[model samples]
Structure formats: C-alpha cells, structure tokens
Target: DAGVTQSPTHLIKTRGQQVTLRCSPKSGHDTVSWYQQALGQGPQFIFQYYEEEERQRGNFPDRFSGHQFPNYSSELNVNALLLGDSALYLCASSQMLAGGDEQYFGPGTRLTVT
Candidate 1:
C-alpha cells in the first residue's frame, strides 16, 4: 500500500500569498498530521486530523490550518504567508489508537516565500 503522498514536491510564494498542499494517507490509516521542518531543525508538529476532525494541534499560528476527508486524505492551508513560514511541510499518517506512535511521513512540500 502507498505510505503517504504529498503534492507539489516544491512550492514558491511571495511574502503575502497563500498556498495549499495536499496529502493522502496510507491505506487503512485514519489520522493525518502536518509538520514543519526548517533548515537544520527537527520536524515541529503543526496539527493532526482524525475522523475528519482536528484532534490535536501544535504551537503554530492561526495561519496554519488543515482538513481531513472521509477518505483519509488531507490538506494543509497557509494564509498570508510570511518568509518565516518557508519550510519543509511534511505530512504524516498513522493509525488512531488509545495512544500510538511512529507516524509515516511523506517526502514533504518545500515552500519558499521570497
């Protein structure tokens, strides 16, 4: 089965433009999480989606939002992008249990805001 898939392997935007990235979780998976990784930094959890609802979120601004579909696919939307927002946006997929670990991550969508 497909592990996870992300669109536009790379993306570029200006300081104030918006961008939307897509992700498809692995087969049989019900949870999708978004992460941001800057250069020389570890992935920071952005938010998590399960059962078509946002279950958990990280310490990101309101500009970062996401949605999950019934089919387990997801989308990450960033509004009023800033240069600081430029990072490797990663999409991770995992099962929803009482407490689970080890999420499968996609290559990532590299976003650069000039």
Candidate 2:
C-alpha cells in the first residue's frame, strides 16, 4: 500500500513569504495530522483533520492552518512565515479517530525560512 508522501522533500523561503506543503495519507487511513520538528526537537503536533474538518490543534499561532480533502489528503499553509518556521514539517496518518492510536509519519518537507 502507498504510504504518506510529502512534496518538495526540501524547501527554501524568505522570512515574510508564505508557504504551502502537501501530504497524502497512507491507504486505508482516514485521518491526517501535521507536525513541526525543529533541530534536535521532537515532533510537535500542529493540528489534525478528520471528516474533512479540523478535529484538534496544538499551541501554534493563527499563522498555522491546514485543510483536508475528500480523498484523505492534506495541506499545511503558513502565512507571513517567520525564520523560526524553518523546520521539518511532517505529516502523520492514523486509521482511528484523534489520538486513538499510533500514527505513521512521512519523510517530511524541510522548510528553511531565511
């Protein structure tokens, strides 16, 4: 089965610009969650989507937002990105509802905001 995949394995951007990252969940999975991983830090949950609606979110700012589609794919959009936004953006998938089970992650889309 095809697992979760993210685009632009790596990315570079300016501090004030915006960026959008995409993800496709693993087959048979229905939920998608987005995470941000800074250097030497663990993945921090940004938000989660289920039934095409945002089900849960973490302590991120309003600049961090996401969307889920009917096909179970997802996207992460950051507005007025800051240098601190530079990190590995990971997308994880799960078969159950929010926090009900373990999630499988993608390789990640590395974003470098200068």
Candidate 3:
C-alpha cells in the first residue's frame, strides 16, 4: 500500500491569500485527520473527517476549512492566509478502532505565506 500521499509537495502564498492542499489516505482507511506543525513544535490537530463530514475541529480560525470526498480523499483550505499560517500541513489517515485511532501521516505540504 502507499501509506499516505500529499500533493504540491511545497507551497508558497502571500498574506491574505487563499490556498488549498490535498491528501489521499491509505488503503482501507475511512477517517482523515489534518494537522499543522510549526517549526520546532509538535503537530497541532486541525480537524477530522468521517463519512465526508467534519467530525471535529481545532482552535483554528474560520479561515481554516476543509472537505472530505466520497472516495476518502481530503483537502485543507485556508482563506485570508496570514504569516502565522505558514507551517507544514499534515494529513493522517486511520480507522476508528475500539482501542483508539492510530493515524498514519503523510509527508505534508509546506505552506509559506509572505
């Protein structure tokens, strides 16, 4: 299996700009999770998608949004981008097991806002 994959490997955006990143989950995975990782910081949970619905979200502003497709793929959309929004956007895929969710992360898309 391909584990997880992200697109546009790298990205650069200006302040107040809008950007979107894509992700494909591993085989047989139904849930997708998005995270933001700033330099020297741990990944911060952004949101999660299940059955194409936004199951959970983080403290990010409204500018940060996302969508999950029927094929189990996902996208992270950020509007009115800010300098503070520059970070490594990570995508994780996993299934909701009884024990817990063991997420597998993608390489991530680096978004830089000038």
Candidate 4:
C-alpha cells in the first residue's frame, strides 16, 4: 500500500552523460506522469504512460525517454545531459480511467548536470 515513490533523491552528472530516474505509482494508479521543474518555475510536463505505452509527450527532445512497466512503475531516461537539464524531476500517479484529475506526487529527484 505504498504511495508513489522515487529513488536516488539526488544525482549529479556531467554534460554528455546519461541518467535514469525511477518511480513507482501508488496503489490502484495505472498511469504515471513525469515533469521537470526548474528553479522558481512550475513543473513542465515531460510525458505520461498508461498500459506501458507512452500516451503523451511534451516539447522535450528525443534525448528524453521513458518507459512504463506492467506493474505501473515507470522510469525517466535522459541522454546527453546538458546544463539546461538540471532540474527537479517529479513523478505523479493517477488512475487513467478517472480522467487523471487527481494525482499523487512523489518526492522529486533532484538532478544537476554540470
């Protein structure tokens, strides 16, 4: 009965590096969404997953990728990290059938790319 959770609360990487952040959805949630929040800015949608398929994506480039597993857990992968990639990566869970109106958020993973 654990709620949404994310791992490696903080991470540091250099430019051109790659990193993967993981998330587990709350019980009963079938959809997972990823967002990136820059300092003093609102979270920007990265993508969403339902039934292990990427349902939607934002304006980010292909360097940003992700996957959803059968158990509803998800991962966000970013490649060729740039300094601009530094941000707090947030993960949220919701029931796709509920119109995803209510989301349970996980403590974000802070990523810093030098």
Identify the leading candidate in terms of TM-score: 4
Between candidates 1 and 4, the lDDT winner: 4
For candidate 3, lDDT tens digit of each residue in 1-114? 789999989999999899999999999888999999999999999999988999999988889899999999999999999999989999999986632268899999999999
lDDT of 1: 0.92
Model 2 agreement with the true structure over 21-45: per-residue lDDT tens digits? 9999998889999999999999999
* Residue 23 accuracy (lDDT) in model 1: 99
lDDT of candidate model 4 versus the reference? 0.97
**Prediction 2 TM-score vs. true:** 0.96
TM-score of each: 0.96, 0.96, 0.96, 0.98
Q: Check candidate 4 and list the clashing pairs.
A: none
Per-residue lDDT, model 3, residue 103, is 87
Total colliding residue pairs, candidate 1: 0
| Local accuracy of candidate 4 as per-residue lDDT tens digits, 1-114 | 899999889999999999999999999999999999999999999999999999999999999999999999999999999999999999999998988999999999999998
lDDT of 3: 0.92
lDDT of 1 by residue, 7-65 (tens): 98999899999899999998878899999999999999999999999989999999998
Cα lDDT listed for each candidate: 0.92, 0.94, 0.92, 0.97
**Residue ranges of candidate 1 with Cα displaced over 4 Å:** none
- The per-prediction tally of clashing pairs is 0, 0, 0, 0
